[model samples]
Target: MTDTSSKPILILGGTGKTGRRLAERLTAKDVPVRIGSRSGSPRFDWEVPATWGLAMQGVGAIYISYYPDIAVPGAAETVGAFARLAVANGVTRLVLLSGRGETEAQRAEEMVKASGADWTILRCAWFSQNFSEGFLVESLLGGEVALPVGNVGEPFIDADDIADAAFVALTEPGHVGQLYELTGPRLLSFADAVAEIAKAAGRDIRYIKVSHDEFAAAMAAHELPPEITWLLNELFTEVLDGRNEALTDGVQRVLGRAPKDFSAYANETAATGIWSN
Candidate 1:
């Protein structure tokens, strides 16, 4: 049997939330990795097809984490083309980080499946890191997290746990052809999530439920890019409409243990003082 770990694994969006954590785990195991990012050495850019080939050279596997998000328009085609390219370049193993309750996400999964490569799909719920490391970070620092959704629960998984799962799929065998619906052990509303963060940070952060129009106005006031504005709107209006509220045992199935709870994520993140101004 070939030592797959000895070959380089190209991690797209390698500097991102889950990708970076996954890279750390792979490096700890002495597995070689090539960061597939615009800023990486080979400069892998989804917009530039030329860069993709260079980055995939000699790579045995790939972790595809699309930029901005995979739920955006044309994302399926983009990811499909990338997967096809990886296969054509003689790299067959692939792992994808996807969002739960997303149409485009599932479409991209089908594209990867059709690529004729060994694939593992991790359809994930919201990331607990969003409050500390993502768009909500600003809202947390600003003392308020206002959105359009109300009472809709989301099972937010920890990124570290996600990294661990990806590490297993990439280095260990028997993960191909599997689709893991990764989520935390419990569900929490956006307000509930904020309250947990507040408790951990020992600060008074408020989460207010607003109308979709109000949320759009706030995004406009912040001057976020048009695509980002669109993504946020779609997530709040369509996807979060009680579709992915149910919890899953995906993390346990993949890693042989329960996924981290959101409260635990809050407590650990608070100690890092990222929530502290």
Candidate 2:
């Protein structure tokens, strides 16, 4: 048996959504953890290859949550290179957080598989935390969340569930070579989601549909950085085109329970007072 007790689990993007939650869970279980992020100790930046070696040292497994989106150009090459490097450095396990319906992300998955490491792929849909903890939080706080989406429903999974599944993949057996498509129990349009938040938050919030060009112009008018604006535009125009409207049972298959509902998520998050301001 591999002596995993002495080896720390490396969590890339460890300060971000899923990675942070995973790190917390592992720590509670007394599993050694090394955070791999630009701000983490030893400073691991995906753009800086020199930091990877130090971060990978003494790491037995890795939970990889790529910054930005994996659908961007050159992401597959970078993932492939990183996977090869991990294997060369004796890292044995990898759990990749990927995107649903992204061809480029699928390519990156293949690279991890070919790298000779025990790997599990979590191809996830949009996250429910986007409203409470991510880019959409600002729009939610503004009362009117406007976007280019037009009645397209997305099965948004909870970040906590993703973390749970990732923990099992990292520490447990029998998950190697598995590709799990994780999604919520049902689908909800952006408008439906906002309405649920409004109900839960006891406030009036509106969801406005706009043309892609108009949305881009609004982002520019807000003086958002060009790179972020371009990425959001691509996500709205390309990724949210009803390609991932269906729900999946990956969470149930992996965790053996129904994934949490959006209403439950909205209610719990609203109670936290994050949407109040």
Candidate 3:
């Protein structure tokens, strides 16, 4: 276990997908963790800057996982401010969960680097958990997964792999000032991924390629939050257009092992019955 100087590592967005898993791993290793969420003590809100000071108190390091996304407009400034605040408060070790190929995400990465902290950026591809643990679960359970993307291949990384990489980055030495681009071992289209899940779950799941407008209409019908609707539409349209198709060795570089394949993730998550009808 890495020494934290008796101060907890604060995880921003600690209740979120990757943050939650990272918290579990840290706690299991006897590392003290302070969850930075709306429901957490002292209540860390991204929109409310006052709560940030209390959360950073006596923390040796911090895992920065921005809520909603780092791809949204003005996210760079917000994250930059938080990073500066963390550094000013004597918390220098900053690990940011970033996105690949998004201009805003890139900008936010630059901001973190400019903060004069020991920063490591995990520039990641699409998460495999988006299917089972995210908005697509309802559609999969309904027997069909519809999206606006075509045959563009994506190296969908597993959230567990991300957590493991982050664990190494946060707890170990020599990761300072590293920017890791993480991806799964296989290049899988959304349809191909759904098929893998279907095979694993022993169910007849269909993948439908809908138009962009059709996707927006579907999200609207579900009455999702405006930010979520816009984020999904933007992701399925702009971000999924073959920009992040290739695989990277970030996982292997960080963990000294190949990333978990999509098939393996499908099989394991299916066993959890998340995709079962």
Candidate 4:
């Protein structure tokens, strides 16, 4: 059995959305945090096996937030190998940031579960930050957010809520062997979400519905890498096929509070001036 009492917590993607927030929260609580990223001190790269052991040194727990996404090809194998390595390096706890309604992500989740580490899976919905902090931000700035989506509603969870849940899972003892399907308090269509942002930002933003092929062509025209274009296309088509329309009690279950609504996210993010040019 691994002794986690004094070991530093390893957070992969420590500078990313949820990872960054979790790291901040943990650090504020005086928890020893080892950021694991290609650019971090004692760099940890998911594609480079040679760097794993160094980051794993004295790490009692790990937050696995795969880059690109876990739904991409070969994510399961890579995550599985990493989990095994964590066990070998004396890491006893694993918290995986996963995607809801993704078969590939589920496969990766299974690999983490079987890794012999005390595991907690945070299977989450589309992030509310996607508008302000991610790929859609440029579109929001341009006043037009076009996508290959229609009336399908998604329960967009706040990344902060995800970070909070992860913090609990990593530090608390009751979360082991639990799978938390995190979602927002309410569901909103892509168009509805844009409208909320527009209302919050006091701007005119149009939500244009384009065909999947057309969206792909536009992304390619913008010179996005082929892999990224492919991943976006897959997520827009397959993952958003009305599969994750309902709200889950993950936030309430884990944190004993209702998840933040999209309106709150939009309002708070609008204050940051991310939507304004």
The residue-by-residue lDDT of candidate 4 on 92-125, one tens digit each, is: 6899999998888999999998889788999999
Looking at model 4, report the run of 10 residues with the lowest lDDT sum: 1-10
Clashing pairs in 1: none
lDDT of 3 by residue, 1-277 (tens): 2347588889988898999999999999889999999988868999899999998898889999998899988899999999999889888899999999898999999999999989999999999999977888999999999999999999999999999999999899989999999999999999999999999999999999999889888888999999998888778878998989898999999999999999999999999998876
Better of 2 and 4 by lDDT: 4
* Candidate 4 or 1, higher TM-score: 1
lDDT of 2 at 75: 88
TM-score of each: 0.98, 0.97, 0.98, 0.98
Stretches of model 1 off by over 4 angstroms after superposition = 1-5
* Candidate 2 Cα deviation (angstroms), residue 4: 3.1
What lDDT does the true structure give each of the candidates?
Answer: 0.92, 0.90, 0.92, 0.91
- Candidate 4 residue runs with Cα over 4 Å from true position: 1-5
Ranking by lDDT: 1, 3, 4, 2
The TM-score measured for candidate 4 stands at: 0.98
Model 4, position 146: C-alpha lDDT score: 93
lDDT of 3 at 120: 94
**Least accurate stretch of 10 residues (summed lDDT) in model 2?**
1-10
